[model samples]
Target chain A: MKLGRLNHVGVATPSIADSITLYRETMGAVAIGEPFDLPAQGVKVCFVDTPNAQIELIEPLGDASPIHGFLAKNPGGGQHHLCYEVPDINEAKAWFEAKGARVLGEPRIGAHGTMIFFVHPKDMGGVLTEIMETPKDGH
Target chain B: MKLGRLNHVGVATPSIADSITLYRETMGAVAIGEPFDLPAQGVKVCFVDTPNAQIELIEPLGDASPIHGFLAKNPGGGQHHLCYEVPDINEAKAWFEAKGARVLGEPRIGAHGTMIFFVHPKDMGGVLTEIMETPKDGH
Candidate 1:
């Protein structure tokens, strides 16, 4: 259950375009990836590369988007979650459950195309946490 | 103005001891640092090391602690800020100001013993962002 490298920091934003602009011109981020729609996940996402990790800019895709409530609470956006990689998703899930931490749901393919699951914030020091299986190609 | 590395993620917690336990037992963080008080900053701090970056757990030291308001709003505690390194703190401050983003204050020695300044959340896409001068030994 050792946490691996931090995969990314999820930031829920109202607009990915505006976020990209800020990351580029203001934050001097030079390796931002293209923004793409993830209809199944109900968000548009763009990854801004940092030296060690990434800043995931996520915008609500539809009215029923999961981040809608977060945006309503913080209209200007905010750090939504932190994703950390693990060697195996199921093992991580079981480890968390064994520790009496609530695993939000069954592991599923995540935005990074790897198995992932969310841990309940109440059980994770009030921070939304995502556990992800290391990508096969080592991203 | 290029960003150096993702230095750390700041997590505000009511108790650094409890946070450390969670990180060590549940998160399997093996490199948890000793908790220390920064009286001048009005916060108790501890660092949980990840392969790429660190998680800084902060607890208010007194009534005037800067994070008191944040903890009041989110009693369970929450992600407080994200810090990135820059080669030059002063240059970074000027760059952000020129781009119409408000630098919170003049650069001052931060927890890492490096010069750092914060950018207003409103001007930083809703995330309180800390820009730090890269440590001389390259931490």
Candidate 2:
């Protein structure tokens, strides 16, 4: 699957409020949109737009949230995954599987009403990577 | 400073060749670009293009490489930094400084001949962040 654009960089933070302060006051990232809660994903996400792409800071709401697990292991916030925007989720999954990369989950619906999937950390050289296909938003 | 499009994601790797294969074979990234050696930056970088942005696999060449020191502390590849394309480096640096973020270095020449500077991890909640301004290239 070909990449579209960098959709966002996902970060696991102890507190989204503090993270947003650093991203905005310190890094010059502006709040361009509203926050989204993915109940199924077990996290709340907020976006900060940079010049090139968006930075998504995620804080887990429950014990089931992956962010909670990540924070439990790493303590403070650390660099997480680099998400690549793809055009088609199925095509991307097929391409990744054909290449012997370990896929995390079957293509599923995600934030922004898009289809997304993840490549395991092992196949991606120890860094978690996500591929997303943006849905058409009526203008 | 506003971001442009994402230029690339920097993945710190112990073995560049291994990481490159994963990207090319598994992720469908094309190695259509040349390998760039940034001695001053202390690493050899290979650029692979995806549909939207690029993935840069960085390997430290010697003891002088910062990646080497980073690996010494954290071992295995980790997410390095999210570099945003900026229109003005000086302006961005000033903004960061005002916000109490430690600026790693003055805006200087960086890899791939761009003007770039880094923000200390202390301010970003443990993630290194960079801002870059690229000159118009003659094609």
Best by TM-score: 1
lDDT of 1 at B63: 89
Q: Assess every candidate by TM-score.
A: 0.98, 0.89
lDDT of 2 by residue, B40-108 (tens): 789888777665556677889767898987677546686787666767778878877877888897788
Q: Residues B1-139, candidate 1, lDDT per residue (tens digit)?
A: 7767999999999999999989999999999988988887789999999999999999999889998999999998899999999998888888999999999878988889999999999998899999989899977
What's the residue-level lDDT of A52 in candidate 2? 51
- Model 1 residue runs over 4 Å out of place are none
DockQ versus reference, model 1? 0.89
| Share of true Cα-Cα contacts across chains kept by each model | 0.88, 0.66
TM-score of 2: 0.89
Count backbone clashes in candidate 1: 0
B-chain TM-score for every candidate: 0.97, 0.87
